[model samples]
Target: MPEGPEIRRAGDRISRALVDKEIVKSNFYYVRIKDREEIVKNKNIKEITTRGKAMLIRFKNGWTMYSHNQLYGRWTVNLNTTKIKSTRALRVVFKTKKHTVRLWSATDIDLLPTSEEHEHSFLKKIGPDVLNESCSYKLIEERLTSKTFHKKKASTLMLDQTVFAGLGNYLRSEILFDAKIHPDDRPFDLDKTRITQWAKSIKNISHLAYKTGGFTVSKYIADRNKENGEPRKSYRHAVFMRYQYECLNCKSRIERKWYGKRKLDFCPSCQIQTGKIKPSR
Candidate 1:
């Protein structure tokens, strides 16, 4: 799944490529949108913005096209000044004077009301966007400390978009591992200092990932050659896909468990479970 950083990067790229440009043609595949003909035939892209994992492309005339890439969806910006054959799998294509932007296999494509009332109605349901500068630490702290979240596993809570937006599976695992907190541990059992530290780390790492375009285990990989360096192999084997490999920190064997059909990898020595905790209401 594409996380917050990837979504933010896509937004930045699309904005740079299409902002202020008049659309010459718009095409859709696998989706039949009402009023799409009116939307595509004549309109200019005003701005592009992201909300959680979704992208919003605003038009000059109060129409906003929303899309969520989900897992396999991708977009490509064509600038070679050569016409290529359009594929039937293409979901949406926006052509401008300078570039052609093609969206392929997106899970969602919708037209939305552009009014603040409509926008707020949708935004209010989601938690703080990790990439938004205006997101408050107080809000995150309050939400995590609430009675409703007390006994729930921190891992499960992190996956809830209402608690924190822009966190995907890999990020949740990495954040918990960095905090030295077990995924199944109860949120309230965590000390206030640790909880605050975890939140801060999440924000910092999120920023880094956003700046870097995406999070890979490579960022944590150590490079030995200062002159002409190559990333150390051990760093590449961290919590992501290295299921049974030895833990880089403690040398203990890494373990894997199924959590709601998702594979979670963690080091047994590095992350010790406190005990079985009751689920939050």
Candidate 2:
């Protein structure tokens, strides 16, 4: 599944291709909204934004188009002259003067008034967006200390979009590994300093992934790994998918535990459990 960074990047691409440009034509192949596609015809796209894994396309008017790329959705942009073979999976098309932007395979789509967008099921309860400039360490720290989320396990909370928008499974693993916090630890189990580190890690790792095209490691390390003939899938992250391998920070073997049906990886020596109280950094 595409995580927050991936979705945000998609939004950036769509924004660059369509924002401010008058849509000469718009097509929604999505069954329910296909007939209502005239709503955006000849209108300018005011802005395009992402909240976690969902994309919002705001028109010059008060309307907003929402789409979630649950698992298979993808968006592609090309010049108007470029030819893309038609497929049954095609979901949306926005043809501007110079470029054609297409959304494929997205099912959870809606068109709603921007004024009432707050009522969206997913957006209504989403926590601070880690990539948003306004979502700072102070905001995350407050959320961490809040009674509503204080008792949840870090492993569980990391995947909870209500706790931190844009955080998914891969991010959950990378952030916890970066902060050197055990997956089993709760916000209440962490000291003030540790909690601060956790907040910082959530922001840093998330932004880094966005900046580096989903890489959690530094450019130097990534380059070194590539030089060693390591595939991106094996080197793009720290503990995620690297289970049973040596940890990047510590030489301890990485371990994976099942959270229901999902997998979570951690380094036993680096991310010490709460009772052990070993400071990682």
Top-scoring candidate (TM-score): 2
Minimum summed lDDT over a 10-residue window in model 1 is located at: 222-231
- Those runs of model 2 whose alpha carbons end farther than 4 Å from true positions after fitting are 86-88, 278-281
**Candidate 2, 1-281: lDDT as tens digits:** 89999999989989999998878888888986766677766678999999888899999898999999988899999999997886649988899889999999888998888898899988999888899999999999999889999999999899988988899888999999999999999999889999999999999999999988899988887787667666777578888888777787777999998999999999999998999974579
lDDT of 2 at 125: 90
How many residue pairs clash per model?
0, 0
* Residue 263 alpha-carbon offset, candidate 1, angstroms: 1.1
TM per candidate comes to 0.84, 0.95
Each model's C-alpha lDDT? 0.73, 0.89
Q: Against the true structure, what is every candidate's RMSD?
A: 4.9, 2.0
